[model samples]
Target: MSFARYVEQTDPPRPPRETLPTMYDLPSENPEEPGLPDEFHDFQPELLRITFQPPTHLPEQVFSASDMNLYYNVRYPNWYKRPDWFGAVGVPKLYEGRDLRLSYVIWQEGVSPFVVVELLSPGTEEEDLGRTKRRNDQPPTKWQVYEQILRIPYYVIFSRYTERLQVFILQAGHYQELNLSESKVWMPDIALGLGLWQGEYAGIHRLWLRWYDAKGNWISTEAEQERQRAEQERQRAEQERQRAEQERQRAERLAERLKALGINPDDDL
Candidate 1:
């Protein structure tokens, strides 16, 4: 099917609330198909958990937790895409009785993810780049999904095999490729940015997506910070012990000098 025709028939109107539940209320797990690989399946979830945090509270805007699946019904009902990691800044904080949702339903959430990241794999390479062709009746291509419909501010794709990072920023309702310096790009929306650093994360070392400060310093994880603190404490303790030993040696010298003078310290006391 041609990509152009699919977008023509898709309904631009929003669905009614009574019809179906939003994506957020559903489970984040995909029952029909297992996602990516063992490494991605495990680490991606951890990334979602660690990265997902809302900004300050507001009357109309709410924050979305990471790992929430985003869904939109287009020409094809079953067609959907779940980014390995995602974050929406201006969504409501709670839904119904729950703290939030498992997936982000655009029709229901009333907002789209500000940023979406896809961990590239051999199987998903074509689709992640919007090169996959669906039936002519289907909606926009994967490229169109992030670019046109979602209009997400930032879209990031990382290939583990190649250790490459690509960034897309929304401009005039379309995505323009952004230039990177040394494999790193900054996004002020998430109060962080994406960078390709050769280091260990979750015990695996390769090119990895990690947060960084505005000055381009790598942001350390909680565990990394703790390790640094412990090392500093150890150094301080060793210094104290050395100082005490020096004092003890000085006292011994003074006592020896007194003894040589036939003035025993004990007798004087």
Candidate 2:
């Protein structure tokens, strides 16, 4: 019998997971060079940074970065993890109160990231999802550095292809997956929530992860706020015009009635 006919006659089929190369088997990086980010990686992080509003902190006290190398180890000083997007509350927006930081050093900053978001990429999926094993000599993996060493409070992962969002919160020194309802995760400590927003951002409209207020409303960007203000002004002007037109018609009717009664309306005026 042919191989196809024999398989069709078989009672149970073989699983692809057994034969195919798993994520672990794939190389995480090339030793010679760093990976280049795609367009989604650039745009998504910008949206998160723009909309991130920590209610309790001032604008200058909240620092959010994208594709920035975060150095965690004090001993080695060179070991770092590059997050797609990360937000740190209670930290000065400027490093040492004056300069923009090229990278975030945990030891110098003394404040760990309040939240870290990683956009899923096929090349780094294993490490991003904490599926890869850590070597004994090398520094901790990205997941280990974020969860164990840095102890970041919130870790979020989003897959563009599947449009799936996963939220993990640090509880009792461990990371626990949150059961998000409608793709929303609320952080009571920061008084803000993160959810998937469907709208145009940077001239592209799709599902983007963004911050929302406590009342479950998506936080607006500066451009969006301006657009809303302009719309409100237009509506007010329209209402005023309608009111003026009504008053003018009423005055004209009264003038005609006075003329019909043999009284000159202009003489009384």
Q: Which candidate comes out best when scored by lDDT?
A: 2
User: Model 1 — TM-score against the truth?
Assistant: 0.77
TM-score of each: 0.77, 0.86
**lDDT (0 to 1) per candidate:** 0.68, 0.84
lDDT of 1 by residue, 1-269 (tens): 43345455554664455766555445667677764575755574465445343333353354534344567653333456677777666666665435546666676666777877887777778988877775646545677888877888988888877878889899987788888766877776655666766777788876667667666667666787799999999999999999999999998999899999998877846
Prediction RMSDs, each to the true structure: 4.4, 14.1
Cα deviation in Å at residue 196, candidate 1?
1.3
- For model 1, the stretches where C-alpha displacement exceeds 4 angstroms are 1-15, 18-20, 23-30, 44-68, 73-79, 91-100, 253-269
lDDT of 2: 0.84
Candidate 1: deviation at residue 12, Å?
7.9
Instruction: Put down candidate 2 lDDT per residue, 100-119, tens digits, no spaces.
Output: 77778776788999999999
Best by TM-score: 2
